[model samples]
Target: MAMEASEIESLIRTGIPDAHVEITDLAGDGNHYAARVVAESFRGLPRVQQQRRVYEALGGRMGGVLHALQLTTAVPE
Candidate 1:
């Protein structure tokens, strides 16, 4: 089953307390989502590390409840 958008957002927000997140359903299907996250925690991290951090925050929901996620992470200037 696909995960709730709020739950997904909550999980990410909880992991990165000061995150600015934007979630989009690319195919009008809940299974496919794109999340753009900006957080202070990613300040000095590499692009891969930043994205990985967000994935880790999901705690293994990536291929289960949460399906495909086109994720992007950035730090606010």
Candidate 2:
């Protein structure tokens, strides 16, 4: 089954409490998503680590139920 956008947002928020998360359904399919996450915690982290943090927030669902995610992370300006 495809994961809901709300579920993805909730997971990210739960993991990164201060994050500002925006999720988009790229293909109009529940399985594909594009997420833009902004967090103060990401300020000093490298891009890879920032992405990893978001992935970790998904709790191992990345290649399973969550299929594909186009993710972007940034620190608050």
Candidate 3:
């Protein structure tokens, strides 16, 4: 099953309440998406860690309901 953009946003927000998440359906299909997440909590984290946080928010849905995700993370300037 494919995951909805709103559901992806909701899950990220749930895990990172202070995050500013932008989710896009790259293929016009729910299976493919791109997400750019900005948060104060990510300020000092490494790139890998930042991505991990976002993945963690999904609660292990990366390969299940969600098929492909091009993720970007950053600390707000």
* Candidate 1: Cα lDDT at 36: 94
Per-residue lDDT for 1-77 in model 3, tens only? 88899999999999999999999999997999999999999988999999999999999999888999999999999
Model 1, range 2-52, lDDT digits (tens) per residue?
787778899999988899989988887789999999998898889999998
Q: How many backbone clashes does candidate 1 have?
A: 0
Error of 1 at 55 (Å): 0.6
Candidate order by TM-score, decreasing, is 2, 3, 1
Model 1 segments more than 4 A misplaced: none
User: What is candidate 1's CA lDDT for residue 61?
Assistant: 95
Tens-place lDDT per residue, model 2, 6-61, is 99999999999999999999999899999999999999899999999999999999
**Number of clashing residue pairs, candidate 2:** 0
Of candidate 2, the 10-residue stretch with the lowest lDDT total is 25-34
Listed per candidate, the RMSD to the true structure in angstroms reads 0.9, 0.5, 0.5
lDDT of 1 at 30: 84
TM accuracy, model 3: 0.97
The deviation in Å at residue 74 for candidate 2 is 0.2
Worst 10 residues of 1 by lDDT: 1-10
